[model samples]
Target chain A: MSVEPLDPSTLPEHDNLPGNAHAYCVRLTGPLFVQTGRMIAHYPAGGGTIRFEPLTATSLGTLVAERFSSPLYSRDWVVANGQGHVLLGDRGYDINSYDLDEGNLTVRAANLLAFDAGLELKESIVPGFLTLIGTGRFLASSSGPVIFVEPPVRVDPEALVGWADCPAPALHFDAGWMGHFLGAARGALFGTRSGEERQYDFTGAGTVLLQSSERLREDPHALRRLEGEVRQLGPGALQQLQAVVQQQLAEHQQQQR
Target chain B: MSWRLRTPRVLVVDLDGSRGSAVRARTGSMVACEGEVSFKDAGIGGGGGLRAALKQRVAGESLPLMEVSGRGSVHLAVEAGHVLLLELAGEVLRVESESLLCLSEGLRTDVAFTGLRGASSGQGLFTTSVTGHGRVALLSLGGPPIALRVTPRTPLVVDPDAYVGCLGEVRQSFVTDVSWRAVVGESSGEAFSLRFEGSGTVFVQPEERR
Candidate 1:
């Protein structure tokens, strides 16, 4: 049998759909910043309309410039303005809303679904994270319900969703792996990896968010970040990068063939 | 003798070799069975006759079905998608062909034009409409299906990729935010959304169709 159909009046203001953790509903009273392609559906209030405007929209320039400070993510976000109940789902992941009261949080860029206009967003020092500063609510999704762990914890890079009130995590390579890598011969370039040699070491106050699953969805922003960093290389470095890319492409083609 | 859900994703239909107990299910959806059973092709039009077949071919909403009849219980599943069972009481169910898993013997399937709305969502310009009184099992990808209610006062706008189908009386139209930036190829992903007005119930999945 089908579940009871939810209307705007019955829908929660900011919560996951009843009996379903993957879908979220947001009652849009003011402008909300949402990631591209995350909105699944929306119900408009009578006599009002909702518009999803890109960050570059002139009408939203002042609000966006004041709240959004990440140029690398400008193309990946939009401003949803109007009166309505907006529905958002991300790859069937479990979505949860977090409230910040004059606090700050840094989330993996890909896991972030949407945030409030009052929250100031900045790119974290970490390459693939965004920090939200101020008092507001934000939505994020993970492969499963997020597990909160205190600092002095080491998490797999793939399972680490984000951290709150914690300093930037340090890259921790397994001691055995480091020793083996340094002791191995040159031909070991094709190193055998268990995919667990790297971890994020959290060693300060605050909580860390971890998903139950270690499966990572491909993040388009990660590729864009890499492309952005490529421009900083000198000519010699660029040539070496080109050679490396070609080698990787040749190996991929060989494997496919 | 009866239809039972083995799980939210698995459907078990029992047949007693009676004409009334037979079922038409999507081809290749049979994952397991017990006792003696026989499977026969449901033909090109999915047992809706030649007109339905022709319309389906033109609309690109073809459903390849196989009729199962025998003294045995059969298990049905597709693509590991979540299955939802809906019983029709003379009301119409408009659904995507790919999402239809199985139908009891008394239902009739036809094609209905969905206009330019499908072009953007990649679901095609037509949807499969099921009428009559029977049980229908629908499949949803990614996660559990979400049902939303619509009224004259509260119209629903949806991303086409997340739309599964609708029940009762509902009218759908294409909504596009056509600005100069769209022409310049810098438009947001929400450039095209589907608006549903009138009174009815709409179903969407937790993930968009890629």
Candidate 2:
């Protein structure tokens, strides 16, 4: 087999795509918050026009509503904007491309995948995380390769993938499952066990983004943050949260018989 | 067409069985083979006869090949993705019979209709092409196989979920754009895009097969 055929005049000016680390090739000269369908191929470099928009449209729409302040993930994000070269790709994971310069990272909003509208997207009190504050270039994607630990680490809540400059994770559990959830019949018999006794600990002082595949990647803004916390429950706390979710679906169908 | 890549997603081939060779693959994609191999059923159509088996069941474009040939060395792969290869000589590759996989013995495969965007991506506007010469591999997933060059003033625009497979004579079209169907379903999965211009070469694969 005779390989070698990349063309786009030898791609790779903004990185990855040579022997692919899950593809990425951004050379576009302005605006690029991309995420909308991770664009696979793009080539212009001459007769302008790239466009992707959608951050509530209207072109740069007030600079993407003033730097896309995550409305539970500004409807999947977009704004590839003009010039040429774009090429991004995810779902085959392992993308990389960081360089935040003005710092602040966070990521794991489905492993990011393209940024640089001069960064600034927020919304990340953990839940399906995403921070990105300022200073250019970003492009994450990781199902593997992104292990830059350092910190009192605890990880493994599905291999936690987000933490740069730390301060979020703190729910370690596992003190013998908190003494079996402070005993109440071993908290209903180890509370239907297998939460793997949780983890995520992290402790002060930066960097943590792990990901050698704990296989997550489905967070649709955590169902819009549980429908905005079930629209502020009421009605006797939604019938006591529906009888504790029908006794946790009859103890998960009695532990699947 | 010898075909070697023992790993880049595996694919082997060989075949000499004292001169009586063979190939076909892609129905349960082999995985191993020594000497004197066998395995039948290149059936229903992949053999390309009976009017290319009624145009591969009226172009639902199924493929399902498997005719391995004799005299050792098979081994192919599929679900681990990434395999690429390619070597034709007459032209015409088209692809997407689940991104083909193995095809050496005198090549040919059919089906072509490609109209309303592979039937709105549910994969049925048809497109399997192939043609003479030999060697064709291809299996893409998230890596290996980026090759985009389509000239005539360079027009490419892919992303019909990272559409994989295209060799030459290009010219595809589809685009849509009504603000990409007004940012449909909050983008991240196509509001239509497959543009490609004539001249050839365009095998993408950085994930996105939805």
Best by lDDT: 1
**Clash pairs (backbone) in predicted model 1:** none
Q: What lDDT score belongs to each candidate, Candidate 1 first?
A: 0.86, 0.79
lDDT of 1 by residue, A20-47 (tens): 8889999997899998779999987876
Where does model 1 sit among the CAPRI classes? medium
The positional error of residue A26 in candidate 1, measured at the CA in angstroms, is 1.1
Q: What C-alpha lDDT, on a 0 to 100 scale, does residue B17 get in candidate 1?
A: 86
For model 2, residues B7-102, the per-residue Cα lDDT tens digits are 798888888753335778889988777877888988878888788789877666788898887776888998888898888899998888887888
DockQ of each: 0.60, 0.25
Q: Against the true structure, candidate 1 has what lDDT?
A: 0.86
